[model samples]
Target chain A: MLTSGIILLEGGLLNPNPGLIFWTAISFFIVMLILSKFAWGPIVSMLEEREKGIQSAIDRAHSAKDEAEAILKKNKELLARADSEADRLIREGREYADKVRTELTEKAQQESQKMIAAAKDEIEQEKRRALDVLRNEVADMAVKGAEKIIRTALDAEKQKAVVDEMIRELAASRN
Target chain B: MRVKAISRILALVVPVLLSLNSHVFAVTAQAEAPVKESATAAAPAGPATVAAPEGVAPAEATATHEAEGAEKPGEVIMHHILDNKVYPIEPFGEIHLPEIAAKPFGIDISVTKHVVMVWLACAVLLVVGLTVGASFKSLSSKESPKGMANAIEALIDFIRTDVAKSNIGHGYEKFVPFLVTVFFFILICNLIGLIPYGATATGNINVTLTLALFTFVITQAAAFKAQGVKGYLQHLTAGTHWSLWIIMVPIEIIGQFTKPFALTIRLFANMTAGHIIIYSLIFIAFILKSYVVAMAVSVPFAIFIYLLELFVAFLQAFVFTMLSALFIGLATAHEGHDDHAVEGAHH
Candidate 1:
C-alpha cells in the first residue's frame, strides 16, 4: 500500500485526464446555452421591471412634494393678503370715524353761533319799541296837566312848580 | 398505489445493490491476482528480481489502469480526484460507465466521475434556473421573489451587478447570460464535491482547463469583434516600436494565454489542495492505527480543513468568475474604456 501510494503520488498527481476535459467542455457549453435561453431573460426583465417601478414611485413622490410646496406657498400668500386687507379695513374705519367726529363738531359750533346772533337781534327790537311807547306817554301827560291849570286860574309860579312835579311822576312811571 | 410504491423502491435499490455486487467481485479478483504474483515471486526465491524497478512499473501501471485496484491512501486520493470510468461507492460497488474512443485522435470519452457530477450539476442548474423562470412567469413582477425564486434572484442579481456589470462595463447585458451560467455551474460543482461519494470536477486540471478555455474563446472572440482583424493583430505588438515587436509580440501572445492558464491553475490547485490537506490529515490516524492519534490530532484537523474547504469552494468560484469577466472586459474594452480595464483586474 505504501509503495503504491508513493508511486501514484509521484506520477499521477499532475496528470490531466483528457476525457474529463472533453466532457467538461461539452457539458459546460450545453449548460451555458440552455441557461442563457431559459434563465437569463426572465430574471433580467423582472429586475428591470422592479427598477422601473421604483423609479416611477420616486417620481410620484417628487411631484407630490412639489404640489404640496406650491399649495403651501399659495396658502401663505392668501393669509398675507387677508392680513393686509384686515389692516386696511381697520385703518379706513379709524379715518372715517375721525372725519365724522370733526364734521359733527364744526356743525354744532356753527348752529350755536347762529342761535346767539338771532337772540341778540330780537332783544334790540324790543328795546326800541319800549323807548317809543315811553316817549309818547310823557307827551300825552303834559297836555292833560296844562289843561287842568287853565281851569283852576292859578298864579304863574305855582303852575310852574306843579308842572315840574307832574313831569317827574310821569318819567318815574315810564321807568 | 402500493404496487407503484414498491416498484419505485425497487427501482432505486436495485442499481445500488448491483453496483455493490460488482465492486465486491472486482475486489476479490484483484486480491487473488496480487497474491498469486507475490506467491510466484516467493516460490522462485528471487529477491533480486523482485527488487528491480522496471519489473514493478508495469504491475503498478496495470493496477492503476484497473480502476477498482487502487488500495493505498495516495492511490485512493488520486483515483477520487482524477477522472475515471466509474462512480465508486466504497464498501458497496462502482458503476462502470461507457467509454468512447475517438478514432483518429485516440481520446478517451468516458462519462467518468467528474463527467457524471458535471451532468448532475447541470441538471441542478437547469431545475433551479427554470423553476425560478417559471415563478417569474407566474407571479407578478412587482411581487418580491419567494422561496427558491428568492434565492435564485439574489444569486442572479449578485452576478449581474457585482460580477458582470462591474467587470464587463457597458454592453455587459449581452454577456450576463454566459457569466451567470458560469458562476452558478462552478458554484454547484464545488458544492457537489462536499457530498459523500461525490467528486469535485473543478479540482480536475482538465475540467478547470476546459472552463478556462471557454473564457479564453469568449475573450478572444469579443476582442476580434471589437478590434477587427487588423486591430486584433495590432494588439499583439502592444503599441511597441517595430524594433521591439520581436520581443513584445510573443510576450503579448503569452499574456493572452497566460491569463486563462493562471485561471485554470488557480481554481484547480485551490480546490485540489483543500481536499488533499483534509485527506492527508485523516490518513494520519490510519497510518498510526491508533484511536488516540485520530481523536487527538487527525479527526479535529481533518474536520477543520473540511470546513475550510467549504469556504474555499465558494471563494474559488467567485475568483474564477471575477477573473473571467475581467479578462473579457480587458479584451472587449475600447479606447475610452481603458480606465476601467485595470479596475476589473484589481478586483
Candidate 2:
C-alpha cells in the first residue's frame, strides 16, 4: 500500500508526470460535479434574485420620479390657473364697482335735477297767486273810490248853479 | 594672375580634401572590424554552422548580440506565458509532511512549485468566496446595498441571471457557482498574463484542455443523470434511420471530444498570438539598430496591441463561459422518443 501510494504520489496530477492528464480530468470532473451539487444552485439563485431585486428597484425609482414630476407639473398648472382666475376675478370686481359708481352718480344727478325743477314750479305758482290777490284788492278799492267821487260831484253841481246865478248877476252889473 | 590663382586654389582645397578622406577611412574601419571578427569566429565554428543570415549588417549583429545578452526572445516568451513571480521567492526550504505517512489509509500529497501557485490560486478563490459569503450573510435588510458587497453582488447576479440561469434553465441554480468560478478564474488568469512577467495558466493548452475536459464530463454526467444509460444511447440515434446508428454514434462521441479540443486551441492561440506580435515588433527595434526609428514606431504599436490584448482577455473569458453553458444546455436537453418509433414500426 505504501509503495503504491508512493507510485501514485510520484506520478500524480500535481506533477508533470505521466497520467497527469488523466488524473487532472478525473479530479476536475469530480470537483465540478461536487460543487454543482453542493454550492452552485443556491449561489446562482441568490445572485439572480439580487439582480432582479436591483433592476426592480431601479424601475421603481424611475416610476416614482415620473410620478413626482407629473405631480409637480399638475401643481404648476393649478397654480397658473388659480393665478389667472384671481386676475380675472379682480378685473371683474373692479369693473362691477366702476359700473355701480357710474350708475349711482347718474341716479343722484337725476334726482337732484328733478328736485330743483319742482322747487322752481312751486315758486312760480306762489308768485302767480300773490299777483292775483293784489289785482283783486286793487280793483275793489278803485271801484269804491269812484262811487264817492260821483256822489260828491253831484252836490258841487248844485252849489255851482247857485253861485252861477250870483256871478251872472255880478258880471251883468260889471258889464 | 596665374600665380595668385594657383595659391588661392591650394588654400581652398587642402582642408576639404583632408577632412573628407578622414571621414571615409573612419567609417570603413568601423564597418570592417565586425566583418573580420565574424569571419574569424565562423572559421573555427566550421562550415556546417549556420552563417548569420545576409543583409544583417555588423551594426545589426552587435545590436542583436546586446539584445541577446540583455534578454533572449525565448526567455521573454516563456516569461510572458508561464512566469509566476507574484511574491518574492521564500528561502524557507522544503518541509516534508510527516502527516502523509501517519494516516492508516493515507493519501500522498506533496507540494511543488507549480502546486504552490495552484494552491495559492485556490486559497485566493476560497478567501474571496468566504468574504463575499460573509457579506451576503450580513445583509440585514434589502433596502439598499452598501460597500464592496454591492459590487460583488452585482457581478454574481449578472453571472447567475445572464449566463447560468438563462442557459441552464430549470436546474440552472445548481451550476452557477461552478460557472461563475470558472469564468472568474479564467478571466483573472488571462488578465494576469497581460501584465508584464505574469503567467497565464489558461493560455497553456494543458490547463485549458483540463478545464474543457471537466466541462465535457459534467455535460455527459448531466445527460446520463437526466436520461438513463439506455435513454442516453437512444439520444444519439435521435431523428435517424435504424441503419445509421454506427456512423452517428462515433460522430457524436467525436463531437464531444472536439468541443474541448477547440476550447483549448482557441484560448491558447488567442493568448499566445498577441504576445508574439508585440514581442516581434519590439524585436524590430533591436534588429534595425536605429534607436530613433524604434522609439518612433515600436513603442506606440506595442502599446496599442497591449490595449487590444486587455479587451481580448475579457472576450475570451466570456466566450469560454458562454460556450460551456451552451454545451451543458445541449447535453441536458430532453431525450427524444425516436427509439419508441423504431420499436413500434418493427412490431
Candidate 3:
C-alpha cells in the first residue's frame, strides 16, 4: 500500500501539467486552423461539386423520362384517334353503298315503266293506222258491192257509220 | 479460417515465449537498474524532473521483481498504464525526453513520452492533411479519388455528414473542419499507442482535459451565440417554478461543466484501462512464473486484450467526436424545444 501510494505520488500521470496542456492547446489550435482553411475548405467544395453534378444528372434523367413518357402517351392517343376515324369512314362507306344501290333500283323501275308506256303508245298508233286502212278498204268493198247492186257511190258520214258497225261486229265475233 | 487458426496457435505459443522473455528481461532489468541509477547520480546537474532520479529506478526494478513473485501485480499494471519521461522504442533503446521548466508555477512542465507522441500525431496529421488537400486540388473532376485521398474522403464524409451535420443541424457546415480535425487527431493519437514503443497521448488526463476544454469552450460559445444573454440566462432556469430555482439553477450550471468533464474522464479512462488490462493479462504470466500457465492462458488472454485495445482506440475516438458534436447541437438548438417541454409538463 505504501509503495503504491508513493508510485501514485511520484508518477505525475493523473496530474494535469500546465506546459503540456499549453503545448497541446497550441498544437490543436494550429491543426484546427490550418486544416480548416486549407484541407477542409477545398475537399468540402469538391464534395459539394460532385453532389451537384449527381443531382443535375438525376434531374436530366427525370426530365428525359418524363418527355419519353409524354411522347408515348401522344402516340397512343394518335393511334386511338386513327382507330376511331377508320371505323367512322368504314361505316360511312357502307351507308353510301346502300343509298347508291337503292337509288339505282328505284331509277331502273321508273325507266322500265316509261319504256312500257312508250311501247304501248307506239302500238296504239300502229293499230289506228291499220284500222283506218281497213275501214277504207271495207268501205270500198261495200261501195263496190253496192255499185254492183245499184251502181252508185255512198256519202262520207254513211261510210263511217258503216265501218264502225262492221268493226264492232268483228270485235264481238273474235271475243 | 487461416487467421483464426494462426491466432489460436499464437494463443497457445505466445504466453510461454512472453513469460520466458519477461523472466530474461527481469534479470537484465535487475542488473541494469543499478547502472542507470549510478549514471543519473553522476549527472546531478540534469533537470530534476527531466531525468528521472536514480532513487526511483531501483524501487521500480524491485517492484517488478515483486510483481514477478505475485506480490504486487497491480503496481506493475499501473506503471504500464501511466506516462513516463522515457519511451521504450522496441528492439531499440529508449528515447528520454528533455524536461523543459521542471516546476514553473508549481506545475511539472516536463516533456513526457505522451507529449512526444502527441507531437508525432500532430506531424502525421499535417503531412496527411496537406497531401490529401493537394490531391483534391490537382485531381480533375472526372477522376474518382484514389489512394490516400480516397481513404481520407471516406473519413471526411462520415464525420461531416453522419456526425456533424446530423447533430449540429442547419449551420453544421461551419463546424465540419474543426470536427474532422478533432476526430482524426484523436484517432491517430489513439492508434499510436498500439504500436511498439509508442505512447497513448489521449490516455493522459492532462491531454484529454485540454481537448475537452476546447470542446467545452466551443459549445458554450455556440450556446451564447444562439441564445444571447437573456435567452441563455433563461435556459439555465430549466423552466421550473421560481420556488425551485434555488435547486434547479445550480444543477443546470453544473450540468454544463459536467458534460466536458464526462468527455475528459471517458476518453482518459478508456485509453488507460485498455492498456492496464493488456498489461495485467501479460503480467499474469510473470505472476505465475509457469511456462504451461503462460502458454495456455495469459498469453492468449493478453493477445485478445491487445486486439480489444485496438478496437477501443477507434471507438473512443469516434465517441469523443460524436459527443462533442452532440453537445454543440444541444447548445445551438432552437427554442421550440422549450415549448415541447412545457407541453410535456402539462401531461
lDDT of each: 0.74, 0.58, 0.75
Residue B277 shift from truth in candidate 1, angstroms = 1.6
Candidate 3 residue runs with Cα over 4 Å from true position: A1-13, A86-91, A124-171, B1-71, B89-93, B102-106, B336-347
lDDT per residue, candidate 3, B1-347, as tens digits? 24333444443344344445555565655545564555434422212233233475774865643333322344444445566676655344556789876575676777777778889999999999989999999977778999999999999999989999998897988888888999999999999989876778898898999999999999989989988988888788877789999998898798788888888987886777667656656666665557988898878987887897787777778888988898888788865445224323322
DockQ for the candidates, in order: 0.32, 0.06, 0.37
User: What is each model's TM-score for chain A?
Assistant: 0.64, 0.63, 0.65
Predicted candidate 2 versus true structure: per-residue lDDT over B197-233, tens digit per residue: 3555565555677778768877889889877798778
Which DockQ-derived CAPRI band holds candidate 3?
Answer: acceptable
Top-scoring candidate (TM-score): 3
| Global CA lDDT computed for model 3 | 0.75
TM accuracy, model 2: 0.52
Cα displacement (angstroms), candidate 2, residue A34, comes to 11
Residue A160 shift from truth in candidate 1, angstroms: 16
List ranges where model 2 is wrong by over 4 Å.
Answer: A1-45, A48-175, B1-117, B141-143, B335-347
Higher-scoring candidate on lDDT, 2 or 3 = 3
**DockQ sort, best first:** 3, 1, 2
User: 2 or 3: which has the higher TM-score?
Assistant: 3
TM-score of chain B of each: 0.77, 0.67, 0.76
Name the candidate that leads on lDDT: 3
